[model samples]
Target: FVHYIAKEMTALPVGARVRIEGLVKAKEHNAKRGTVSRASAPEGRVGVKLDDGGAVLAVRPENLERIDDGRGGTRGKGGEGSNQAGESSSLPPPKKKPSSLEPKQRTLKRDNAILREFDGSPDPNLLVLYYHFRDNAFDCFNSSEYHAQMIRYYESGLSVRLVVPRKIGNNDYFLVGLRHSREDKNALCEVAFNCKRSFSGISMLVKQRCFVCHRAGAPHCSGGCRCACYCPGGCEERGRTDHGRLCRLVRESDVTVEEECMQLL
Candidate 1:
C-alpha cells in the first residue's frame, strides 16, 4: 500500500498505478522564510509537478506503506513486496477484442446514411470520417492515435489526407497558414464548400461557376454577358470601366499574366 508522488501524472483518476522509485522522509520546513511556500519546500511534501506546468498533491504518508526501498533491502517494518491488510490491487482491467463485423458493420451503417443524403451517387473515394479520442497533444504531427487512424484508413483501401495543423498566430481555425498560395487556398476552399454542400443539401455547381468566373476577373454582368474579357490571370484588377477591352488586350498581347494565379506569368 505504498504511494509516492510522480511528476508524469496529469488528470488521472484516483487509485491509478503511479510508480515512484525513492525513499520517503518527513516533510521539510523552511527556516529562512517566515511563511513556507510549497515550491520552496523539499521533496517530502508529497507533491509533484506535471509536464504541463501543473502540480498534483500526493497521497498522505498515513495512507501509504512502503514495501521496497528501491534497493535490495526492505526499508519498512514488513519485507519487500508485502501489501498491508485490505489494500486493493491497482492493476487495470483486461482488454477485449471486437467481433469481425463490429467495426465494418458500424462503418457501413454510417456510409449508408451518407450515401442516402447524397442521392445514392456519392463518391465513396471522397468520403472520410475521423473519430478522435481525448488524452494527447494535437500539435504533434505523429501522435499514436493519429498514426493508428491513418493506418486504419490506408488499410481500408481509401486515398485520404489527414491534416492536423498546430495553433499559430491568433487564428482559431486550422490551415490558415498552410494555404499561402492561391492554388492551395482555392483547393482548401473547394473542399470546405463541397463538404458544406454535401451535408447541407445545397447546390454547389452554381457556386463553383461563380468562383471560376470571379477568378477569371469577369463580373456577373447580368448572367452570361460579362463586362470583362477572358484574361489568363483571371479577374484581378479592378476600377476600370473598360475591363472588357483591357481583358481583350491582355489576351491578344504577349505580356505575361502574373501577380494573382499560382502559376508563373
Candidate 2:
C-alpha cells in the first residue's frame, strides 16, 4: 500500500484548479487552493502554483483534488469540489471536449508545417524558415531540447505553418538568441553537444536579407507572405520573378504568425 501510494501520480491537465489535500512532510501547505500549473512533467510529479502565495509545489496527485474553480467552468475537471483525493467522484464525469491549448488543435498546425516544408529553395540564407515541434519541456526549450527541435526543423524543412506551444517546465522562462543554426538532439548514449542554439520564430527572426539579389539586410519584404526579403529598387525588381509566385502562395496560406510576448510600450 505504501509503495503504491509512493508512485501514484494523477493525470491532471495543466491549469486544472486543485485544493491541496493530504501530505505529511510538507503539511504547511495543506488545504491551500491552487491550479495544476503543470500537468506534464519529466519526474511524473504535479506542479501546483498556489493562488495565495504563488509558489509552485511539486506534489503527488494523491495530495491534490480538483475543485469548483468558482468561475462557472470546472476547468474540465468536475462540478463543485469534484472527487475526494485519490477517490473518483460521484460528480458528473469530467468534460471530454478538448480545450484550444490541448494537443489536438496543435497537431494540425504541426502537420501542415511538415507538409509545406521548404528549405529556402535557391539559397537557404535569404528567405525565412520557421522551426516547429509538438512536445517541449521547459528546460528543453533553452537546453538540449532546443537543439533537438532545431535539428528536427532542419531535417523536415517546413516553412508554411508556425510552431505551437508545448509543456514548459515549472517556471516563467525565456530563451533568447534562438537561431536556426544548430542545437542538441536526443543522444543515443546521452551525448554531450553543448553549443549555443540559434532560434528563429515568429517572435524573433533573423534580420531580413534580399532574397533575389543575394544581398544581406534587405529593406522590403513581400507584403503578403512577409518572409521573403527584397532590396529597394533594382533588387526588389530582380527578385520579383521568384518572389511573385511565392508571395501569392504565402498570402493564400493565410497562416498568421503570433508573437510570444506582448510589447509593453
Candidate 3:
C-alpha cells in the first residue's frame, strides 16, 4: 500500500525484462529481490512473473532493476542515457555495477562487507560470507521473511551457506561458513565468534589463520570438513588446492566439528 512519488517513478511495460537478486516464491508479492523475470505491470508498483514459472509477485519499483530497458538497448544503471538529455524517462536505473562515474553497486558491496564486522578468528577477512538458516530451524520462515531478515543484516550479493554454530556461554557463539560446488559438494569452515547480542564480546579464537594460505582472513571451509582461507581474488586457487590435500581432515575431525555445524540452529 505504499505510494511512490509520481514524478520519480513510472510504470514498467508488460514483457519488460527485470532481474532480481535472489530467489522469489510465488506466494510472496513483497519479496524484496530476485533474478530475471518478466514485468506484468509497467507503471504502478512492480509486479513480475518469474522466468521459472514458479510465482508471480508485486515488487517495489526500486527492487525491480531493468536488464533489457524494453527498448532493445542494453542500458545498465548509470548508463549514458542520462547524458543524452530528454531521456530522463521513468525506468528503474540499470543493473548496478561498480564504477565511479556510474551508479555504484552499493548494495552488492555492502552485503559482501558484512563479514568485516565480525572480529572472531578462523580469519574474518577472507572471502565474503552470506549466512543461510536452513531446514527445521527455518521451517516457519518463508523466502520473503528470509529476505527481510537478511536486509536487516546484509545487503545483497553472492549467496553462501551460513551455518548456525555452537554456543559456549550466554555471550559466545560461532557460525560455520560453507561453500558449495556445482557437483553438490560442500566445504565447511568454523567461523570465529561473534557475540550473540551486540557482537562486542568475541571469544579469542585459537585458529586465527587460514589452514590453506596460512594468512589471516580465513573465512571459508572445505565442504563442512575443514576450515581454511584463501587470499582474496588471485589467491583462491591456493585455497582450493590446499583444501584438496586436507580432504581427509574433515572426515577425521568431523565427529566433533561437522556434527555441530549440521545441527539445527
Top lDDT model: 2
TM-score of structure candidate 1: 0.16
Clashes of each: 3, 9, 21
lDDT of 2 by residue, 1-265 (tens): 0111111134366666667754657778987988776775556668888888789888766455555545322333442345544344666755777543322111111122221222123343313332333333101122123324433443443333332111112211111221122222211110000001112222212223455565644554546455455677887776676556555644555354533321110
| Residue-by-residue lDDT tens digits, candidate 1, 88-170 | 33544456575532211110011223323332222322122221225311112212222244334334432222122111122
Which portions of model 2 show Cα errors greater than 4 Å?
Answer: 1-52, 55-207, 213-217, 220-222, 257-265
- Give the TM-score of each candidate: 0.16, 0.33, 0.20
Which ranges of candidate 3 are over 4 A from the true structure?
1-15, 20-43, 54-56, 65-111, 114-265
Candidate 3 TM-score to native: 0.20
Model 3, span 188-256: residue lDDT tens: 111221211111111112222444455643555535443334455655565555454343433333232
Instruction: List all candidate RMSDs to the true structure.
Output: 22.8, 15.4, 19.2
Off by over 4 Å in 1: 1-92, 99-265
